[model samples]
Target: MRILICHNRYRQRGGENLIVDSEKAMLSERGVEVIEYVRDNNEIDGYGLVKKAMLYFTTTWSKEAEREIRELCRKYKPDVAHFHNTLPLISPSAYYACKEERVTIVQTLHNYRFLCPGALLLREGGICEECIEGDFRPALRHRCYRASYIQTRAVVRMLKKHRQMGTYEKMIDLYIALTEFVRTKFIEGGIPPEKIVVKPNFLRNPPDPKYGGDYAVYVGRLSPEKGVDVLLNAWKKIKRFQLKVVGDGPQRAQLESMRVENVEFVGAVPQEDVYSFILGARFVLFPSVWYETFGTVMIEAFACGKPVVASNLGSMAEIVKDKETGFLFTAGDPDDLAARVKLLIDDPTLAIELGRNARAEFDAKYTAEKSYERLMGIYASVIREKETV
Candidate 1:
């Protein structure tokens, strides 16, 4: 089948970007014709004041993107249009183009942008559902986006405009939620339950299960929302085990300044290296403060036959089964995290059992083959429904 993929990349590279790239590659590898239309958030940096102000209304609903997508639909006649991200660029306008062209539209909800202005559903280092519960004024008051009132107001306006226009309700055909927890939130925020499907991200080259494991690892962006500080603090309290951190972001300087003897920062490594690190690690630490739509790192750890010690809230709790495949700790609590990590460290036999179950879980649900099959089913179902209408 011919597919057209669209994404608006973040200023800094992230999981969404990686997922988009991986999906495209997987499709091509499977002999499906794939076309890509991409835009970057970096474009906003070069815009003038007037242009920036005008973006609030049109940013998430661009006529130019609509026109371009319409032309692509006519030229390529793709069977499905799979969109990863379209925030601050590409916009919800592309969905209208697909709707007009009678093309199947499949959108992957990588974050909570449609329901919350901050996208993370986070504020003051915790989960905040003000926008989901009501209007986005609380986001404006708190300066949620980039901690800038103007930027936050702009995002809020964009969300409010699309919502009023019924863009999400009318334009989107299928919503590919990363987890059941995220699907619940989207439904609570007014998205139709029947239209939403759960499809977690899959790794292209996952690690093979090993007999023994080495150090405990943390691999993700080093940001306040990721709870890197909590991971570091937790490691400081526990002296028996070693913790290796991968990836770098805004919190690097702060993480570097603190002297922790047991923790070592390896910085950001390539995708292959990350998988290798996961294979070598005894367990992966995922101490996120926000309500993550899906913890890709946790899945990666599972794919590598390594169990995870993740936050008890959000998708992490759903993904990592406590005492089964892995363990869960209270979000933002260093003491809880340390205790769980110590449990795994102290019990090698239990860790081995968890690792074995983790690999089995990955084989059953989190493989690229499984993802492709599920995606094809969703596309076919959407297409058939649209044809009937």
Candidate 2:
């Protein structure tokens, strides 16, 4: 099958970018023809004042992107058009181009942008779904996006425009949600349930399971939303259990300041080194405060035969089965997180069992082979439905 993958690259590369690249490579490895048409958010930096002002309206419907995609479709005539991110770059207009060409459209819901202006159901270091539940005016009032009223207004306008245009309802065929929890939120936000499918991100090349090792691990951006503060506070309360935090972000200075006896900040490491850390760790920490659409790091830890202690809300609850594969503590609660850490440290046998189960879970549900099979099934279904229509 020939596929045309579309994406708008974020300023800082993230899980979504990795997934897109991995999926394309997977398809190619399986002997399927794949082509990518990508745009970068960095382009916005060079725009004039007038163009910057126009970005708010164009964010949801880019005529330039639509025309460009239409031209690509005319030349490539791909069997399916799979999209990752189309935020302030490609825009929702690309979907209309696919519709106009009668092509199968498959969109991956990498984040909650469609439902929340901030794209993370977060405000003031906690989970906030005010925009998803009701009026987005709260987001406007709080200046959620970049903490700028103008930026927030732009995001709100984009969301409102696409919503009114029926872009999501009419243009897209299939929506690939990374987790059941995320899928439910999309449904609650008015997306058709039948059209949404759960497909978790898979590792391109997973690390070998580490049977036993020392130190606890934390991987991902060291930002407040990631619950680094909670993790640090919990570590301070605990007497034992060495915690090694990987990855660098805005919260580095703050994290460095609160370094306890057993807590160590290793800063940003390469992706391979991250997997190595996971393989060497007894457990991985995912104490995120905000609503994570999906926690890719948890799965990575699982792939390395490491159990996780994640937040007890959002996708983390769905991913980590408490006392089974891993444990879940109340989000942003330092005492609860510390208690859970103590539980894991106190029971070595239980921790080993949970780690074993986690690796098994990864083999069963999150392997590259499984992901490819599921993706192919979705692609076939979308194509058949489009043909029938």
Candidate 2, residues 1-389, lDDT tens digits: the string is 99999999988777888888889999999999998889998998999999988987888679999999999888899999999989887998899898888778999999988888999989998778888854789999999999999988988988888788888888899999999999999999999899999999998799889765678989999888999888889998875778888989998998888867788888888777888888888889999988798889999989988889999999999999898888999998999999999888888777788999999999999988999999999999988987887
lDDT agreement of model 1 with the native:
0.88
| Candidate 1 clashing pairs, residues 3+ apart or interchain | none
Best by TM-score: 2
lDDT of 1 at 236: 87
Off by over 4 Å in 1: 45-54
Model 2 vs. true fold: TM? 0.97
